[model samples]
Target: MEHTRFARFGMVCTVDHLASTAGLSMLDQGGSAADAAIAANAVLAVTAPHACGLGGDLFALVHEGGGAPQALNASGRSGSGADPGRLRAEGHDRMPFQRDIRSVPVPGCADGWMALHARYGRLPLAELFAPAIRYADEGFPASPLLAPAAAVLPGVDAALAPGDLIRRPGVARTLETLAADGRDGFYLGEFGKGLLALGRDGAAGGSGEGEYTEADLERVNADWVEPLRARAFGHDVWTIPPNSQGYLLLLALAIADRLDLPRDPSDPLWAHLLAEAARAAGHDRPDVLFEGASVDGVLASAAERRATIDPSRRARLRDLTSSGDTTYLCAVDSEGMGVSLIQSNAAGFGSMLFEPATGINLHNRGIGFSLVPGHPAEYGPGRRPPHTLAPALVTRPDGSLRAVLGTMGGDSQPQILLQVVARLLASGESPGQAIGAPRWRVGPGLTGFDAWSEPDEASLDVEQGAGWTEGLQERGHPVRGLPYGGAFGYAHLIDVRPDGVLAGAADPRALISSAAGR
Candidate 1:
């Protein structure tokens, strides 16, 4: 029995129920899906402040008129204070997450969201911001997810107290200004002064060595490019262009293509294939996927090389950190348009700083550094980190967009999405079934020798007396059965069927998710 419900003209799908309500209200007011998305995003920033906020990165994959999608890279860049020379002079080879003002970059999100809204918006900013502004000012109820997020995160109480109006008067005013003047107001205008002032103070400096100035914000611009993907099983698979973790999703698809199996949801072989595909993606991460400007370079490589890969190598994945921070949202309108998007602060409560003046939190993508100096992705001024932040869209043969997705587990997000996609395409699982099914992750497996990985019979068998763990053990993978409800990525994916019927699944792991439409 399918537990999913379908709706028509649904303009909002989100990880937070309040955000979903906010967006749906806009749609009810005759707003486009994009406009509703902006409202929902704003609400999430206010409510799920620890997940992501205006002070972070906002990347979107917007599709229109059956055309190729446009990719917007809203990840902030290094500030003027981000001089590589200073680090070298200080005898530091690579930067860490806790740098002084030198580490904080000009936030690219507020402008990014405004730019997208301007390109495809209808309602004015004031109407769109009402829900978020009201919630922030009046205080909304906290969900279970937020409680833990606050507990794990630093400066939570300062950002917002549980049950308080949690007002971000400054940020709300900033949004109010954006509602009036648009993106330019945030990136190139008086808001620039506020950012500079924040930098001058101790807001961005726990390490006290930052060197940012007004010049960085003035020069920072949101980049627009073509998103890339490969057609498979009669569906178009879209992902962000390189400099982000887009290719990882494609590589997993390419690997799944190699196996060519029946779509059976309960097949243990399916789980094995997912692990193999993820391993293939993991191994290639350091090579082919990371080198590119336009996605064509790597997309072409993936298309040309969709050969069946050996699954044996998956047993030996590395133990480094697997990314576990970020947020994603997906929505499709009654007009047949679908969106696959992502936004993040790099880490929870990113950059660990919230400027009272601007009501913004900075992302700590700086934490994605290598202490090793000679590594390819070493820290530097104006260099974009290899983000695990990726969003996805799947178009079926019948001109249907079955899914739009992204997840919270950074690098592991691709693996999690891969498993769900495989469940839908080859394993014959419903949206809810695919999302609710047990899950497994590889990076976390090797990162903490004893960490649990959900989903795979191998993971379950090793711990829950299942049979697959024997296969995993025989194959030499260091496998640990995760206790139920553990560290899989928080997935938010929506599926729209033919004739405008819509259904979505927000991973139970996250408390903030909903689907509503009339």
Candidate 2:
């Protein structure tokens, strides 16, 4: 197990060491938690482009000292020219898959940074972005995690080796522009032109047209909304509301909270119950999470579902789907401010629609939209796709911040978060112990199209050494052994003790993830 880093002043935990260092530097420079999180995320954009970048969506849960936590939904909407009808006529039944330009949405990462900075930042934009710009322009050593993924991008050397020095001049220039001109530097400037050009060139494979007008780009803004809350393990859990699959985490937790979960982490029955709860949440998500749907009813139904879980046999769901490539990080300042942030490109290299002018790899978030008419996530103009980026925060009953945590696992995100949170709260595990524990995910398949495609039954993917493996198998779970390191999600967490001490941990699944503070 990884050792937890403890600090009295501040803490920053992220999936990459360089990014974690960048965030720590921000905190040392007297920046707030928001500034630290944005700095870390910017570095991730430069270092881990396959998972997140300027061409992505972001969601966050922010909590200030003695104040209620707030949620930021910075996911972008589908273009005004989106057309589900044309896709249907072309014989498509679901959303377009990744790699197609039509699957790209208006990126909301830049706007998210701006919104976060506007509300809680103490440093200038240029200062917050300096580390990423320097790394992009002067070159940084390629990480083992990034080498193979970067090789797949256009123009990248296929034989790229870990530690090789790599530079992105165009991306550097774009970051410089963003630092100098704020959000306008991206959505209304040269970067925006390059995006429009790609659409006009009909680079959307054989699809009709990839139309993204200035309106779609210009109208992109982050919204600050009330976080959805659920009481579990004597603490209140908060997450980004609908449009984000975060509610799944809450739903699963609610069901588990109502059930007589075993306190032993090694208990096979515990993992089985959690997996069943996850399957139930995944099965019901599509039916309850569309635009204007009442999540209260769904959350209220958790108790009803809790009674159906059979300890002796796995509860099977009719259908389920899950997938994603993303990054999650957390930062905490001396003043009791915490930020749980998540960002993603939807899949590896996103839509793979790299814009030459800006060095931006556009995201395939639009792929989350459905093609079925009248569906909540149906492809349409000015609609935000159902997103998997779910960041979460927890507080004591008296409203004191307790923890800031999250992970990146696409549809498996909530399941991963559930494991970590349950360990941290219900089992009283330390941050390091909780984050380093073996994890399980409920999904249709392990990889490829089948991984994200809707399937008749869901499988439970458990880490190879999990003590409950045989138990889960005997309980009728479709148990699949996942090799340790990289198969599961990379989670980062900051546990706030009642004494104001911060304890943080970064998952070992990521090659260079770290937790640092001073």
Candidate 3:
């Protein structure tokens, strides 16, 4: 692939091959950490177009040198036509959410990167996306990941084109303009017209969707939000601003802190521990959250009171679709910078309404909008959906990056991320060992486990690539094991040693990469 033409590194790590090469090239050019991140994100919009794209949402937590970590939210907003009252009259209240055309929000992924660039980027936006721009204009081989998506849609290949030189020319051109002009160029220009035009013809029924006019896109702006944080073990754990499931990570970490990571996440007993934690933590989504809630500020303030233990129950309930199997990435650069980015289309394919114009798939976030009247996150004029895309970052004492990390798989994300953090910091594992380690996912309820190891319920441990499928089976949780590097929500990690050298690890299960420097 043209995007993979080369690789260089002062310090960088990424989830896609082309993305890594793009970022590494920036680092080699002496670009700052933010520049490399912007570069990597552009490539992801290209190659990993399945789960993420330029027309999507993005969340990042950045820590530059000795500075406190700052967050960036590039999530899209709703249109004026949306109305919460209309949705509730139709009766649709559940999570693990559903997929509908109404879920598509104005994409903020590109703008979000642009926002990050403006504050910390050293190179021009055009330079940051040069590789991706060339690939989109010139072309590159279709990645294996895109094959199924291609086949699923009739005429998607021809509509979007296929073969070695596959490219999203439309989105590429849109990105080119955004790179030159910043966030406004995309949301306010021809790009906005195209997005609105496409979304209007979509198949979902919700407000802010079905009929957004050019007036709406031209007038709408991406809002900047103060991300939420919760103190854990004396360290500050920062995550996405309100309207996202970030609290789940804080809840999971707190729950895990109660249990124990000193043992394996694959143990039968460990499975129960994780399941209980997930069940306990996941229940908060449907009942507690609403549109007006100040999820961020209040979460920490209410941490003492709101942080309730199901004193009687052993676990909590989790919604599957609203927070399901997903994808995530994390990285830190040579400048002592850290980034945690998580993007998704809601479901495996989102609205599954592939835009023939840009190869950009829309999000099913509207599925998360409540059908209940007076609900906070209901489909309405300018309301954000309850999101599962929360990426977490932790800073160690003395002002250095401790862990730059995140995971895929909805509710399972916080579950996996918390355990890995503990494994790396508490268990004394190296970054590689910590991330490459075997993983497990807690379930939606307090019933049986969704364990990937022994199902015997008595056996309590399994190793990586171990006959974990068998272990999970014997342990009573139907487990689907893959060839070692399975979809365990691989977390791209960079462990910042005291001297500042980074020991990096990209989940081998997924196509991830990393490089470090002094």
Candidate 4:
């Protein structure tokens, strides 16, 4: 088991050791939690490009010393030229997922960094970007996670073994431009031109013409909105609102709280109840997950669903779609400020379309949209698609921050977070203990292709040592045992003790993840 790192002043946790180090450097330099989070995220873009990069979107929950946590939705919208009609006519009944350039949403990471910095940065934006720029310009060792997707990336060698040094001068120059010109550096400059060219070329190859435009790029900006809140486990839970699937976590927690869940982690009943709650919450996603949709009804419906769960039997639930390769990181500063942030390429190497001029690995977030004419998440000009990036914050009833936590698993993000949060709040587990415990995921079992397709039969995939597979199977669940690895997702967490000490943990599923503090 991993040991939690405790600190009096600050802490940073991420899926990569180098990224954690970059964030710790910011905190040491007097940067706030937001600054450290942005810095660390920048490094992840360089070190873990297969999961996240300049071309992805971001969502975060930032809680200052007092009041409720704030939500920042930095996800970009489909281009003004987006045409569901064109895709439907071309035989696409659902969103295309295999290297379809039409699935590339406007990149939002650069703008998101600028938005966060503008709100709570004590250091210059350029300084926060320096670590990433250095790593990209010089070289960084390739991680095992980056190897599988390397073939789709331009500069990265497909044959790269773990620990081989790889350099990305193109990405370095793009980062330099972002540091110098802020949001304009990527969206309105030469990088933007490169994206336009890529879009045109991709369209010419049967995707339909004019699927991108300058207006779409120039209009990009992160929006600050109210977070969805729920009371569970004697504390208030918070997550990003719609357009992001964060409410799924809140809804699941709400359902679980009403049920008589077993207290012991090893108890078969505990895993059974949690998995049932996940299925209940997932059932509401297709109807309640669009941009501008209200989740209040879904959250309120949790009570009714909770009453339907039978401890002696598995609920015959239909499966929800899942996909993604992303990064999640969190930071807490001395002043009690906390930031739970997540950023992502929709899938491994995203649209698999690497722009040569700027070296941007465009994301396929548009794949989250539907082609059905009247669907809430139907493709439309300038409309945001449903998202899987869900960052969460936990606080006491009095509004004092308690924990900053989240994970990267596409549709599995909420399920992973639900397990960790339950351990911390209900079982009183330490950060490391909660994060290191065995996990289970309930989903449709397909990724990177037709991710948002209609519901299929759901299956339960439990980590090998979870020891509850037999229990679940006996209850009628189609259980699949998976060896410990990324199938469960990489989660990072920081628990803020009432005494002001911070304890942090990084998931072992992430090969080089770490929790650093002073």
Candidate 5:
């Protein structure tokens, strides 16, 4: 609750209190939003290593005043040695999700940091990294959020008590190298060598994940591409193009837009509409993709699907758990530049491939690749997997930035954003109100599929509050209630108020999620 103490400042929001402070510190130093974002994320890598790290990939939407939003795809590609045929030959029917060499990819977070800094950073890399370095070296107390991951991860020694000091000297040294040498420090220099060795160590029976050569790491660069744009709620929403599931947000919103949403934030009808829209949008996942994908087609199809859903029809709900351990942060500088950045290590502790010398955990983002023969997302050398890190930026037609927003929920990212944006635009809710509202997720259940049935047959999990259980069942949705404040995915938001002031909110459902500004 201490972290939830919200006050108005030049807006910044992040999942960790310390990282939020770090971003505001950058803003106070006259840094641009890009600088603050990288700085905050660096701190997050240390404080919330369970979710993200220096060994992950990053995606961002950066808006420099008076220009279109910039989309940065820093996601890493599969190793040049990656071969789906080999895995298939090894007797695997699908991509493996375990901690193995096969899960590792050339990490892109370091390259992403360099790219943002080269384009928009004001402070030196050393100065920007000071806070993170200090935290990793001198140590900081762990928050409640670290418990679950620490309990399961191999080497993390999470602080037993809330105020206990936790030190990450290896991470500290790694940050120092990065600050001194930039991206090369991680990909081609000392850090890179160590990472390569760790990959070699993770090699399986005959398949070697360590096949990534120095060239693969050095060639990794964050591409600055045009953002995928869609017209929603009278504002333009921008997200990273292709190799990401961002279009799902626009598609779901477009579907919900066709409905008459209840005025009350707690109305169960909002949940039903959002759930159906999310399921419908996810149905056409391949069509709205970034590789030459179209917004018009996605919107038209979503609208058609929306018209077919009957609120009163009950669909089966199943329980399913999606993969991903990710983090999202938002920043708006005094200069009016804004950024929405999301980064991740795939599953928890990512691949569990640790560089014994540096303590860096390699990401398992390759797990996102499909093993199905001929699938667009099928595993291949030099191919980036379908990423779920969807950072969102809302801009008026005039190009004025409206909101910098995102979350850490893997497949749930777009669905959560759909509901949050709807509340912000349709009902005129504040960022905190919209983010804190009860949420629901519809996905494949742990049990087998429910009879190729209606969308409601998907497992539905809603937070316990606002009479969701009784209300949803009455509408014929097979549903279950999760504990209040459980991991329904945490959303961070910074939206521009009508009067030009910036408002920030951290999801109350999460412990230690916070916002701060000058």
Candidate 6:
């Protein structure tokens, strides 16, 4: 039976229940889905700071009244002083990934929220921020996910004893500023000052060398672009263009669209085809998908690569670090408008460089760029790095909204999304069933391998005791079982049905994941 619940007015799905509640409240107050998404994302910055916050980047696919999905790239660019030659002089072989200020970019999330709200919002910014502000000031309970992340914060209580309140007056002040002055409050006012001060101190503390001026902050702006489009499983898929790995999501789906894989979710062949599709995506990722690349060529290449993969053998895949360190959320309104959004601090706790005054943790997104001189994603002044944040939207043949979904899993983002989309489109799985079903990921067989190296062999990691694991092994595919809720992925989905009924689902793997609607 289908476990998904339908809503008439609106729906919100987020990694945290409080965020879902915050968004639903906005919808109840007659705000558009975009407005509700901002509300929920703001709350997430306060509650799930370990995963994402104001100091990170954002990518969104927003569908207005079932119209063509619009794409927003709010990703930050490298600092103007970011020179690859200087980095090599500093004795770094690859882009450094650490708890340092150098990894922090211009921070485009604040501007992202402003742009989204400005386009579709109905309520005042103050009303939208009230919920997050209240939580930061009055202190909500610490989440299970926050416990370990909080323990690492400097000079904070490592222990969250019973009855303890997670009060962050600093975060509250930032929200208050944003509510009043809009984007300027963040990029030019007090928040920007705090960021500059943090950088100065970061250099003084000797973590690493980083230089930033007021100009960098002022120049930060999110771009509105035509979404990269494709057809998969008979539905049109829309995602953000370059600087983000969204094209890879479409590439994987393109492969799936060509094959007649088994529809039975429990069959071993299903997992094999999914993993093979992911493997094909990785091989061509570095060559075809990047800034200014051709969408048609990328899709065509994906089709060619898909034909070469041997179904019974494991394909080479590098071990991308598995950090459950990003938040994805989606909201759809009664008007048939929808917003699918994903935001991140790069890794858990981001660069681990927190600004005490504003309670912000800067993202380590710079690590996404390459130090390799000839690499397409090599670091350069003011260049946007290859981003992993990808949000998605689906539309019917007539261009009506079908669903909005996304997940947080680094390079695993597209892989996880492909698996779920395949189930939804090919097997008739509901949002809940697709999200809650046992999952598998393809990558280097062993953990702790160098993320930058291509592994000589590949392994498929499946949920423990899943029948597909043994079935896959019989077909000569390397298989390993992982504990339930291990490093798989956390997905959130909102589906719009033919009759205009909307339903939402949140992955059960995340303890706080939830969906709320009237």
- Say which candidate scores most in lDDT: 4
- Please provide, for model 2 over 106-173, each residue's C-alpha lDDT reduced to its tens digit, 9 standing for 90 to 100: 89999999999999999998999999999998988888888867776545767578998778877788
Write one digit per residue (lDDT tens) for candidate 6, span 218-287: 8856989889887888899999888788887888898877776998988888888877777776654555
Stretches > 4 Å off in candidate 4: 203-208, 318-323, 448-456
Candidate 1's displacement at residue 496, Å, is 1.9
Q: In model 5, which regions exceed 4 Å deviation?
A: 1-9, 151-159, 204-206, 286-296, 314-323, 444-457
* Candidate 3: residue 460 lDDT (0-100): 29
Encode model 4's per-residue lDDT on 411-516: one tens digit a residue. Answer: 8889899999999999989999999899998754477222223323666778978899888888878787889988788999999998999999999888789899
Q: What is the lDDT of residue 329 in candidate 1?
A: 77
Stretches > 4 Å off in candidate 6: 1-3, 161-163, 201-210, 287-289, 316-323, 444-452
RMSD of 3: 6.1
Query: Order of candidates by lDDT, top first?
Result: 4, 2, 6, 5, 1, 3
Candidate 3 Cα lDDT to native = 0.60
lDDT of 5 by residue, 211-243 (tens): 577888888658998887878778888888778
**Is candidate 1 or 6 superior in lDDT?**
6
Pairs of residues clashing in candidate 2: none
Q: Which should have the higher TM-score, number 1 or number 3? A: 1
Candidate 3 ranges beyond 4 A from true positions:
1-9, 84-100, 152-163, 202-210, 219-224, 260-271, 290-292, 295-327, 444-487, 512-518
lDDT per residue for candidate 3 within 134-240, as digits (tens), equals 88777666655565455543234443333445656876887788877776787777666666766566445544345466666664334456666666655667777
Q: If scored against the real structure, what TM-score would every candidate get?
A: 0.86, 0.96, 0.81, 0.96, 0.91, 0.93
lDDT of 4 at 222: 94
Candidate 2 is scored at a TM of 0.96
Candidate 6, lDDT over the whole model: 0.79
